[model samples]
Target: MSRPRLLLVYPATHKLGWVKRFQLPSLALKQVAAATPTDWEIVLVDEVHEDVPFDGNFDLVGITAMTHQAARAYEISDRFRSQGKTVVLGGIHPTVLPEEAGRHADAVVIGEAEPVWAGLLGDFLAGKLQPVYRAAIPDGGQLSIPWGRRDIFSGKQYLTTQTLQASRGCPYDCPFCITTNYFGKSFRYREPEDVLAELATFSGKLTVFLDDNILGDAARAKPILAGMRGMGLKWGGQANLRFAEDPEAVRLLADSGCIGIFVGIESMAGEHANHPKTGSRYSQAELIKRIRDTGVVVEASMIFGFDDHDEGVFERTVRFLEECKPSLPTFHILTPYPGTALFDQFDGEGRLLHKDWSRYDHGQVVFKPKLMTPEQLYQGWQQARWEAYRWPKIIDRVMQSPGKPVHLLYNLLRRGGISRPQ
Candidate 1:
């Protein structure tokens, strides 16, 4: 008798250097694997960091992919099907477009995978698999924590390999963002005790919290921070800027081993989510200073090319970032990824220039900018990135940051020399 084998595949893509080297375990897959019966043998393949061998024998294949990698994911699904093996597709893109995905997969798991995963596997073994299975959203409950699969990432070199999840979903429905659409308008939190227990497994210096919005709920965050401080761990994750509103929450996070956080500033001029018809969340200057005062370093992310932007946008954006003085500033062109509200807008307006998924990365302009020519949009993006990362500005930002000087210096040296696209 042989044990059932499961192959978990992460799709291949052309991406940033940081994304390629450190292929961390997908917590979504980990949770699904944890729910499987003991008789199954599992193997993980992250094509971004490793070579995926088709020769390996497996009873079932599960692949998770985003919009950019949908083409490659479908290719893999087709290849496995040709080999007379079962393939299942689930993730953000698939969950939103299940009807299209079901055409490629023998079965598709939608929404949260935990509640529906076991049933899907069971049905497959019983030869009663359905075309689509939806996971029930746990009401007033957090996700069940899985045991550490630390061995899975042992060979990979990421900035920090330790990964954990404490929360999910975003309350704001920004047109360009897919998070709110996938997770719902209301935020869901993990139990503080559960989060602490999960954090205890990693002995590494850096703990990455894989959450859409880490500090979404103030009440839940207080206890979670208390527990993290007790553990003495240094962690990072994405969060909303509104966390600065409550002084107590800020203090708790600093005490709880939070060295840095990534906040989506969206745009320097507060002109995101289309036009004045759609609401803008916060003013740029207020949000940046409030987060910095908490003693927690910030990595601010801003998007370019909102409808309101024009020729003057680049210089204004750079000045806003310089004044904010975040430890690191990430600038990206506005991208209309498939399944998002923005994608529909681009499609309707016939602004999309190409369907090449590789360039859909925030770096490239996949569509024409309404206010500027395609050439202007490209040049503006490159100029903004190069200017923001210049030596003098980098030094000033590092010097003003709240973290250890050595850490800041290390980042400065790491970023000292990088080529810009010609």
Candidate 2:
């Protein structure tokens, strides 16, 4: 008379360094637990913190993966299936390449799992699970869905366990981004009251909003921020530079206890510098200053290996970071993930080096650069990290932020030799 047991896994890419280990809990896996039928017994495992139990007792196993984690995910699926357990694969990688994933999993849930999760579970219990279950784009009602289960990760050692999402999807379709293709081009937001109600449930001192762009829509973000003002918890999330142009929104963010933001300043040298979503009319230095002046830390994210970037990009990028003095300056090589326009273009031009899903991580060079060799691109990315995270530079960047304690702690972590490329 016992209910069926389900194992939910968030696969780890590899052993992370000290600083990278300070990651937020897997919001996607937790959300999947939220959507599962109440009658099922759920066990969540985030591989970043613990090892996967291949011999665990469970009737069904579910895993979520991105492009970088696909190889490990497939291996995990094979292991579970070898033990005569039913396995399900979901997330961007599987949703884009279902056939490849299906080669390993018994079923693949494509798109948002909320709409079809109940049905998928029902059919599974009925012994009639299908090979694929596709859910349509979610509407407003789906946006306000609650996390029915969080007890699975309640006591895990994470930098912060408080995570919430107020919205989904992005309207812009950047070539290197798969978000648009996966989540669609329309912004879907949960009601402000619903978001605040969820926030009120968290007892943590800090919260991390996992939205692709927390302020993608200014009107929707304002109310959410306003509601969070008196909550007395520090928060951070990703946002486009355009948020700076709206002074009111910037004020609301600070008033709402937003201590940090991750901004994608992808490329400062090319036509990308002029694109609407990421581009800014003001210089990078000015825009960063404007945001930082609001007592919020700016973690500037930049990408190299664009067609317009030459061999000198590494030093130039380091120089820009030094000049901008963001609280943290993170760099990445341009990775063309599957289902993205960049991937199609690279595949067509025969510029892709290999389809090794593991190396598709942004740290590795997966495609040939238009202006430099792959070696140069990889070296540039490493050199940028080396230069930016060096002790002197880290100290200088930390001094620039108004939130000195938090910035200093973050910089010290990077300097602790955690972020260096393996």
Candidate 3:
């Protein structure tokens, strides 16, 4: 007469080292828990912070993975299957490469799990679980699902446990992005009032929006921002630079308790201009200033190792970061994830160095560079992070960006003093 137990896991992408210890709560696993029936006893495991309970008694085990975490996911899946527990794998990497994932998991859930989760669970309990369950892309209105089970993350230490998503998918499809492939090419937003209602349930003063692009659609974002104005919540999310061109949208974002934003500048020298969605009418400097003028911290994301980049890119990138003085900046080596256009292009050109999934983390270089050696590209990326997070540079950026000293300081302390890979 006991209820079936469901174990949900988020696999760690790398071995836990000093540098790899920073982890945010897994919103995906919590969302999966939300979809599970209340009759089941659900336990969530984030391998980043805690050990996976391989020997735990569970009727079913569900694991989610990204590209870098695929290896760890497979290991976890194999262990659970060995214990006679039915294992299911889902998320971007498994969804894109279902066949490979199926080799390990008893069942694979492709795409969003919301639509098919109940059916899948019913079939499993009936002792007739299918090999694959594909969920149809739901409409924007369907995104107004229940909030994630935040209680699962209760005792864990995290930078921010309050993560919410108002929308799914992105309008822009950059070659290096896997989001469009997984979420589709259109923006699907939950109703503003619904999103506001969910936000009201959180007790934390800070929240992190998990939207791929929070401002993907200005009209949809406006109401959400307006709703947040009186909520007394400080939040941050990723957005495109175009958000600055619309004066009203910028004002709404700032007034809506937006303490920080992550903007993908990608490259400083207009290298990404050929991509329609990345092309900006305003210069990077202008966009950063406009966002900062609203008293919102800007965490500019820049990628190195583009085909157009040369050895001098590191110095030029550091110079731009200093000049623009965004509250915080992140540098990453361009990674070609499995389902992206960049992956296809690199695979065809015989430029991919190896199929090692662990090295696919954005910080590592996995492909041959067009203009520089792979080592040079990786070192350049490390140099950018080194220079950007130095005490002097952090102090200068903090002074340039008006308010959100706490936001700036948190970023600085998190990134500062981390030794770069040789």
Candidate 4:
């Protein structure tokens, strides 16, 4: 009468080198394990920074994968299924294409998994697990499982492990984004008390929030900031530029130990600005000052390769970054990720360069550029990256940062070695 052996794995994929050192067992994976019956023995493997041991004896395997890692995840599923183990697939990629993933897995969970994982385990035990189990977005009573599996993250490059999400989903669905597709157009916030209790667990560690838009809820956000300030934990995360519009919000964020924020400005002026479906709310220059004034370092993201972009785009974008004087820049090529409005538009226009999932990452050009050749797009991206990461430019931005020196130093290191060849 042995208990079921549960295996949970996060699939491997290309990630920023800096982030690889900080990769931890995903909170979602831990939540699923938390919901499962205690009798079940669980093994967790984060493929990004750990090797998967094939010798484990597991009756059930669950994998979470993003679009870029779908191919590898399916391969793992196939290998495990060949060994007679039941495989379950979930996460953004599988949720969107359950039919395709169904080919490799015995079951696939669609959308948020908490409401579905327990019943899913029951179904598996009865040998009645359906091909697809759609998880209902939990009601207000749902308890967010605090991440408690730091043992799985030992021996990683970065020793600090701190992550807590105060909210889920984003209201503004930019055309190129798949966030709204997966999480929905409306944002749902965790109660402030719940979020603070979670934050309180971290004591003095540097936390990184995984929220898509932390400030999407102004009222809920203020209290969370106050709680974080009271907790005195240093943290960083993504938020739309509009968070800067409210001067009070900016001050609270800085007071709350927010050292930096990743802002996806998208483009200075091009397809992102003119795209019929884009929902971004501010111009580049105005948003820059607002964030700087808050004393939070800015890590601005920009994309190149709009139909309106010409050869001059690279220079213009670099100049814009210099003018903005943010702490860091993330230059990406326009990509049409599956399950997004942009993907549908690209499919309709027959403009995809290839269907290769690996190249679909923002770093690569996956489509023909309207105003430039594919080679031009690649070289332009490289040039822009080099320009943004150049030593002088990095130093200039760091010196201009209003946040703590440690954050500026981290930004400089994060943008390392991007200089172009002479």
Model 3 pairs whose backbones collide? none
For each candidate, how many residue pairs have backbone atoms clashing (under 3 Å)? 0, 0, 0, 0
Q: Model 3, 214: alpha-carbon shift in Å?
A: 0.8
Candidate 2 is scored at a TM of 0.94
Q: CA lDDT of each candidate? A: 0.75, 0.84, 0.84, 0.78
TM-score, structure 3 vs. true: 0.94
| Stretch of 10 with least lDDT, candidate 1 | 271-280
Output the lDDT of residue 144, model 3: 56
Ranking by TM-score: 3, 2, 4, 1
Query: Over the stretch 1-422, how does candidate 4's per-residue lDDT look in tens digits?
Result: 59899988877764455567655458777667766778898888877766676668888999988888888889889989988889999988888788988999999999877668888999989888889999764433323554445544555655366766777777667777887665766667877888887777786777888888888777778988988776778888888777777878888988999878888777774444554323436666667777776777888888888878888899989998888877788888998888887788878898897887856778888988788998898898898888777778877877765655865576667666466634
Tens-digit lDDT track for model 1 on 1-422?
58889998888874446645544567766666666676888887777677666878998999887777777888888888988989999987788778877878898888877678888888988899888988654444554545545555556676665776787776666788877655666678877777777788777488888888788788877898887776868788888777766768778878888877888777755455443212336455566666666667788887888787797788888898888777778778889987788889999999998877657788778998889977787788778878888878877877765654744764564365445747
> Over all chains combined, what TM-score does candidate 4 have?
0.91
Model 4: pairs clashing at backbone N, Cα or C within 3 Å: none
- Higher-lDDT candidate of 3 and 4: 3
Model 3 weakest lDDT span, ten residues long: 14-23
Q: Lowest summed-lDDT stretch of 10 residues in model 4?
A: 138-147
lDDT for each residue of candidate 3 in 1-422, tens digit (9 for 90 to 100): 59999999998865565544355688888888888988998988888767999888889999999889999999999988888889999999888899999999999999988878888999999999999998765433436567888887877777767898988987567889988766777888888988998899876467999998899899999999998888889898999887888889999999999988998888874664555655567777887889898889888889898888999999999998888777788888899999889999999999999999978998789999899999999888887788778778777877766675775666666586558657
lDDT of 2 by residue, 159-184 (tens): 78788788888878788898866677
